[model samples]
Target: MEIDYASHFSALAHPQRLSVLRMLLRRYPDAVPAGEVAQALNVKSNTLSAYLAALRAAGFVTQERDGTSLRYAASPAGLSALFDGFLRECCQGRPDLCRGIGGDLQTKKGTDMPFRVLFLCTGNSARSIFAECLLRAIGGDRFEVHSAGTRPASQLNPLAVRMLAEKGHETDGLRAKHMSEYQNDAKAGFDFVFTVCDRAANEECPAWPGQPISGHWSTPDPVAVHGTEAERMLAFQTAYGMLQNRISAFVSLPLETLDNLALQHAVDDIARKD
Candidate 1:
């Protein structure tokens, strides 16, 4: 059945539903519990129930049962569909008028721009930074890499820096960056955007531009460890190790030639690596 875009849009027509989608995006690649969503929005459970139902119905969000509770994750396909459907109908033949908007959502495929990849997480401090440094060292000139946080820390995590330096990766110029910095960088949209959030963080992940191939590479939050100095260093080391493994596997793929669906599968497989 053809979706009634005009009517379905009513799902997000309200401010609360839109905010709910934005909140889920922060934890993209991970699901947020319904209760937590309510807490975060400061809405009563009953009210949030209506908001979530509307989003799910409109395809902005999806929910799954975990035990007896419900967890929600933002649906990328829904947003992509909304954009594509709207443009197809709205811009019909006048591609010139919507050219920039359409182009903004495209990957740098069939171009010599190298693979523009972004690593996202709650904080650009640890797992993401580790991935950035590893890819820079491993992928060489075949990839252009950057990392940013949904809620960036004021500075890069000291433990992360120390661990990277000890591993012989360049830690200079490494700092936490907000995802917003990339908004104005239109011409440099990413081909791949990975979320490295742990399972527990109630994070707000980035709304990646250009429909980049995305997957979740969940790593433990080393920054959350509060223990003896030795134990804390161990946490950073563990997180770094997982990202190193994942990025190393990622750099091995023949990414440039893979079709869109293949690229998506490749990244999803990389996320499952040890």
Candidate 2:
């Protein structure tokens, strides 16, 4: 029987497992300790162990025993197999088009020129909250970023706060603010307005003087999900990973070099990521 690479890849089909892959990919060759991985995903040690085991069995990951800790990294052959497998079978011999799409995915602007970004979603709880935190963490002082919601929730999602805090980013004073707060103001306003959930993107937005660039990220509602504590935490972490990938690319673009049209395209790309 031919080996179904799809089945192997399917092992990483869970939200948390894929998150672990991207997180490990970002830290490749560095071997992040298991404890850190657990913390990053807001998962318990046992839960993380199970997820890691699945990934290892799928050949997507490897572990190195570091004294009292087991650090994890992506397996070279595993990743290549994954890339080749996906590209060969699904891409329909147009790998170049796929590559082009990836290239156009999201490019970061140079660190020299910073842009103020506002992340919007229907509820200020989960997805939008994560996007705001991730962008600031990845961009540092390079970009001014904030988050808001159309129908603002009562608070920031606790899981989101905890997850970002584990990554060394402070979430103090990160309350859920309403989009209307910035909607009518004559302030300088956001250079980019991003809606991270489908509902927010579809709703009418408040007018701004400059009508800052806008885009829709369409992330799933993590707060509405029901599962075991570990499973729920994993959902938030997965969303974080997705937001981080886009933000990483966004922070690397040469925003100073791009004219309005290019910048608009760039922002659009950032908001369109899966």
Candidate 3:
């Protein structure tokens, strides 16, 4: 099929249209309801519909009837064709520009551009916060990690902050934040997003940009354990240990070699560790 390169570019030219594409890519294989998409981007229903229509007309998006509402997803074939065509035309005479296009794009960019990761939970007071700090320490400059809650606590859990500090991780900059801060902003693209609590894992999430690989690591909420100070601290310690092990495993993965599906499976497998 002859790809309409100009139409695809034009469709992607608008900021809102590009935001729609990014959201669609984040939910790539899964079709998201139009209403959900609109809510995530904070775009008005009428405006969102117009943007989606343009994407659909450009062959960049595909829609399927899901009961009464339509669900939309990025067209992988169309996107692949569009990008390949763009690169080919741009590099037609510049062989040097095409030399390092294959393999993992992450590695190709090297560690100068850190991989962005976000951890999510219901409260943002414990598990998610711990994972964020742990991964940041382990991955260092290789990762830019952040954590948030669906319904965030007013502040970081005292136990969590102390536990991380005792272990020599910086807790100064860590604070509980709402997940909504990351949503609706197209520029806040994440490379990977993990939900550390069961509740947040099950809840509907905003569409993230960059098609971030996502997984659930169900760690027990330490705050729920009400006991003596020592016992409560032990619970926090246990949660910390679990996250440390998982983050260790995560950092050791050959991310530069694995494809997206393989990388996703690797991430899911980490959750199975005790």
Best by lDDT: 3
- Please give the distance, in angstroms, between residue 19's alpha carbon in candidate 3 and its true position after superposition: 25
Tens digits of per-residue lDDT for model 3 on 205-226? 6678666778777788899999
Tens-digit per-residue lDDT, 83-102, candidate 2: 66667676775756445222
**Better lDDT candidate (2, 3):** 3
Q: Deviation in angstroms for 126 in model 1? A: 2.0
Pairs that collide, model 1: 25-205, 26-203, 26-204, 26-205
- TM agreement with the true structure for every prediction: 0.73, 0.57, 0.61
Order by lDDT, highest first = 3, 1, 2
Pick the winner on lDDT between candidates 1 and 3. Answer: 3
* Cα lDDT computed for each candidate against the true fold: 0.78, 0.72, 0.80
* Candidate 1 local lDDT, 1-274, one digit each (tens): 4678886788878998888887686566567789888887788999999998888888889999999999999887888787677777777836764453322225445666678888888878888898899999999988889998878889998877887888898888889988888866866477777778743234544456667777778888998999999999988988888888888888888765676767666776676566
Deviating ranges (above 4 Å) for candidate 2: 1-113
Clash number for each model: 4, 7, 0
TM-score of 3: 0.61
